[model samples]
Target: MTYEIALNKAWDKIAALASSKKYTVKYFTDIYEVRISDRMMLSISSDTPASEDIAILVLHYLTGFLKYGYNPKEEWISFKDIKGGQSYYPAYQENTIKPILEKFKEKTDDLISYLTESLEGRIVKGGDVTVELPTFSDVYIRMVLWHGDDEFAPEVTILFDRELTEIIPSEDIAVLLFNLAKRISDEL
Candidate 1:
């Protein structure tokens, strides 16, 4: 189905599930907020071009929550750990990791600074440059970058929380990583 159609369907599902699940819709001037039962579940802004994608992702999260409940397991897991992940290894490396490595080959520090300062990421004590970043209210992704010199080429690896597989589709996980790489690589 087209993204627009899928999004509309998502909205319908969201509304129905929200009512049955007692999720209260909190009105915001520029954003949408949903309170599931008592706890606030999602807050997404409508002022950006990516708002549609955000809404769709939020719907995915809500549906996943309804299906699996909250797993709460925070173990860091690589792409290989995700379902059917191994089959997409080449695409993941080419589409996500390679670009990051290329962009930050000589400017690893700058990327690190941007992620830490601008994105509110925390530097982890590992890799040449390892950071833990929260891309959404409920999603935390880890990135490990290894800068190369004369001998070796630069490399990057992205890992997701173990619960992420249970929260969103694997393809969406790749999309999130791609968005993150673009944000990090874009001239600022």
Candidate 2:
């Protein structure tokens, strides 16, 4: 189905579930805020409005949570742990990681700064620059970016909690990665 159709369906589901599910919806200035979790929040531009891509992401995220309910196991796992994730590993690396590595290269510090400032990403220890990205109410996607000098090529890793597979689909995960990378690139 087209994204528009999907968005409409998600809207219907959200509306239907909102009252019964007790979703927290609030208005902040021009933006409409939907607090999915303490850490994960979604907002829509009330005036000119954000792009449809972001709206769709929020819509899909809400719909997924409403359908599956939030019960994160609090444990991190690579995409390989997800269903059919092994087959999509190459795409995940190419679509999400390669571009970050290429764009950041020796400028890993800049990437960290952009992530923290623009995306509210929190730094972690593991890679040269690791950030925990809160994507949904119960979904936290961690991005580990290993900075490299002239001798080594920069590497990137995107990790998700094991419980994510129970809600979001593998294909949607790819789309999420693409959009997320695009968002980071836009800030760069």
Candidate 3:
């Protein structure tokens, strides 16, 4: 399967796993979105907007949490920074982040497992352009994960270290950064 096909498949898998409202921009070709919500907690997107890609999942949370929502063009501080620097996510938000973090963990783990099963670690190339997996799938997959170099950015580098990017992308590195809008709505 091609990356585009794999990407699309990834979308279907996640949507199946997450039971929530799904939306589409229409303007973007074939690009669809899924808005996950749990009545007892939060909606992945405050507006319930989602993209077919997981990057949309990450984007939904990062900017949506702000009282006024985050602007797309602006730079943002990821969850790791917030977690690392006591100054990022204030103490008052601790309880709020707990469950969402758990959900994020669950979603992240689900994707990783799905990819390992589907990809079989036998191919490293994207989409239809394929390459055979070396004798060591573990080591080969890890190398594929480390495509970019920006070590000082611990938030970005560490994931490739764990072979997450092999499954997910750099855009949605940590699930914690995602906004649990459904959770926020449920609280209200």
Candidate 4:
């Protein structure tokens, strides 16, 4: 579907729920402020508009969360682990993973600093440099990077909370990661 159509459909779904109280209680406003990263915030309300891509992401999260409720297991799993994530992995790698790997391969320290300080991520144990970042309230994405050796090229893996599929579909997850990779790459 076109982004505009998808956005309107998402808004319609949220409107059908009748009240924004649930959202306000969780996010502090009916406008539904969403953090794309620590430095980026998008408001998901008619009065406070956003770009179609961002609006759809915010609204999709709101609608899906309303329907499924937030219940993160705190278990981190790779994108391939999500339902249908395997089929989507090739495109995901090209769109999300490859860009990140290319950008950060040589600037590992810069990447780590950006992830930790700018994005409010915390360094974790894994790969050469790993960080777990909160993409939304209580929802985290883990990025693991392995600098290349002579035998292999550098690699990057993005992971999400295991229960995320219960809230948003794999398609939305892919968009989220794509946006994230773009955002981070753009910043540094």
Taking the tens digit of each residue's C-alpha lDDT, what string does model 4 give over 1-188? Answer: 45767766776766776344334312212245543222123455554645677667676777777788889887889898988988988999998998888778767788888888877889889988889887766677889888879999888988888888887778889988998888778877
For candidate 3, write residues 83-129 as lDDT tens digits. 33344445323543444334334454442333344324343444222
Q: Which of the predicted structures, 1 or 4, would earn the higher TM-score when compared with the native? A: 4
Who is ahead in TM-score, 1 or 3? 1
Candidate 4 or 3, higher lDDT: 4
Better of 1 and 2 by lDDT: 1
Clashing pairs in 1: none
Q: Every model's Cα RMSD, please?
A: 5.0, 5.3, 16.7, 5.4
Best by lDDT: 4
Candidate 3 ranges with C-alpha deviation above 4 Å: 1-22, 25-30, 33-67, 76-79, 84-173, 176-188
In model 2, which range of ten residues has the least summed lDDT? Answer: 21-30
Q: How would the candidate models be sorted by lDDT, starting from the highest?
A: 4, 1, 2, 3
TM-score of each prediction: 0.77, 0.75, 0.20, 0.82
Name the 10 consecutive residues with the lowest summed lDDT in model 4: 21-30
Give lDDT: candidate 2, residue 2. Answer: 46
Error of 3 at 176 (Å): 7.7
For all candidates, the clash counts are 0, 0, 16, 0
Scored by CA lDDT, what does every candidate get? 0.69, 0.66, 0.32, 0.74
lDDT of 3: 0.32
List where candidate 4 sits over 4 angstroms from the true fold: 21-48
